[model samples]
Target: NKLRVGLLFGGRSGEHEVSISSARAIAQAISSDQNAQKYELLPFYIQKDGYWLAGEIAQQVLTSGTPLQLNGSNIQLPNPSQTSLPIPTSPYLPVSSSSSSAQVADVDVWFPIIHGPNGEDGTVQGLLQLMQIPYVGSGVLGSAMGMDKIAMKMAFAQAGLPQVKYMTINRAQVWSNPCVFPKLCDQIEATLGYPCFVKPANLGSSVGIAKVRSRSELETALDNAASYDRRLIIEAGVVARELECAVLGNDNPKASVVGEITFESDFYDYETKYTAGKAGFLIPAPVPESVSSAIQEMSLQAFASVDAAGLARVDFFYVEATGEVLINEINTLPGFTATSMYPQMWEKSGVPFTELVDQLIQLALERHS
Candidate 1:
């Protein structure tokens, strides 16, 4: 009757470390929870080169504080009638050092703690869908839409929702015609104007994101962003409050208490977010009751619009001067560290962290069955 959950993390994406951190949280939290026997947190590592490291060594990686200088060269996903991606086998965790073969336990559920690019951009979700396994968060369409700011904004526009002015530029276009880059900038200047935020189309944790104030800054920002993703999006900066709400469930979802992220820097950039440790956050965002209700309502609607299931945290840009609230983005699978805002919001809303993860597993089975 127990569920064997594969907590998959540490993929080839730029957020590899973030994924590792998240996996540690899931493994520890699930293992220590009172309902531990109800589910098993199987350590599954997708190495930078896509090799599978299993058994106790994988578990050590999940629990250890030191950086892993993995000796693993690579792991292949074999096409098998019985398994999803071929079960990754490694020499370190084998029953005997003399044997190189290993067969991993069957996984009843998959918790992909990945945060960016190939991991969160629907590529992994498509594979999971093909494997006919019920995983958490959004489906392929929703995951893809949420990963790219361009497509997400397009969805907002189609839904008649307000979002900051922005445009997308492919790396191929930028490199294909260096002369055209300026022309493209000129067009953006004429259309959306200055003080833009350059963001990689499919990265998370504020990696490869820059706040640009002028044309000169835009070039450097775009180059930095292009290093992370082939598609780059530039948003005309707006002076708005950073507000976030957590959405849960599959069909009709519920929103958690609103939260505000106050950055000690100019904006919530990479340093302010994951490092620098200068930024502070406020629980139950300081907003009027009416505004809170409106935000929560809109957050649920946005989650539904994307066809998101399980969980998603919808972010919004609310400008106080204009009393305007615009949808900024939706994170289909947000940061899952136990201390992260998503888990915190639910915890404050009466669902404890372990209960939250347990509920997600139950939801996956409920939906799949």
Candidate 2:
């Protein structure tokens, strides 16, 4: 019998469209003749208003390549802090039923492609954990740490991985005490200096990230990022190349070839990331063999440090002047879009897209067993 694979996407995240694109790509690959006989695809979509749409509705959205429009009643955009709303108390699973009532129980395995906030930050993984179902990517601990920049950096520090100097900011502290804001500014200017990057600790896809060159910009950046997540991160900016490596497997993970991201923007922000023709990439980055080997090693180390399983993409900053490689961050459920660095790097590493997805599914099954 074909393995029934449940593909979940369309999450209540800022990266909702990105997640849909990823699911579309994966669905196409799995439905291809190469794997068509081996697996049965079942898609489930979570609407922006936090409603679950399963079966044909999900298949229609994927087929049309657009989000479904629902009635405007009681529709509110999800707040970043309140992303993890309680699951519906329906008798059947949150996913709508078809002919039978137990739609979720029919699946042999799950593949969650949601990115950022609620989906990637362990909420969905926790739900699946409660259901005792096998799913792709990291588990509760790994997803939670990977989504929060502060916790991820702390883990990296504990692992003794080299990274840029950074500091954390709490939204409550800044709001509760007026005097706390200036203290934060003073500390940032004294420690991280003029040019630094401010990011929301619990979001990705560069949604709530900004580059500040002065104290005034830093203040505004903090307010902007705080809207997305309560925990904020300020990192000392570096003049180095942005490199990424893809890691696969569970017990013994493997790192793919190093890839570099080059962009015309001042920084790789949301626009430059999703917008076409804004950035360029160099697969098997134009670096010495030794540098490539070191990056691969660090990538594997970062993956293991976070207890990530199935797959992850470890980003780095390689300083050309000093030849120093710094671990930046890891994405547990990295983007799988055609242009995404994760799949592209693996493709360059001799693992085609179909083979890559197959290996990930096998690894998920392996870990479950």
User: What is every candidate's alpha-carbon RMSD to the true fold?
Assistant: 4.6, 4.6
Among these predicted structures, which one has the highest lDDT? Answer: 2
lDDT of each: 0.76, 0.85
lDDT of 1 at 312: 91
How close to the true structure is residue 352 of candidate 1, measured as C-alpha lDDT? Answer: 86
Candidate 1 residue-pair clash tally: 1
TM-score of decoy 2: 0.93
Model 1 worst lDDT window (10 residues): 90-99
Residue range with the least summed lDDT across 10 consecutive positions in model 2: 77-86
State the lDDT of candidate 1 residue by residue for 120-142, as single tens digits.
Answer: 88988887777688787777998
lDDT tens per residue, model 2, 136-175: 9899999999998998999999989999999898887556
* Alpha-carbon shift of residue 54 in model 1 (angstroms): 1.8
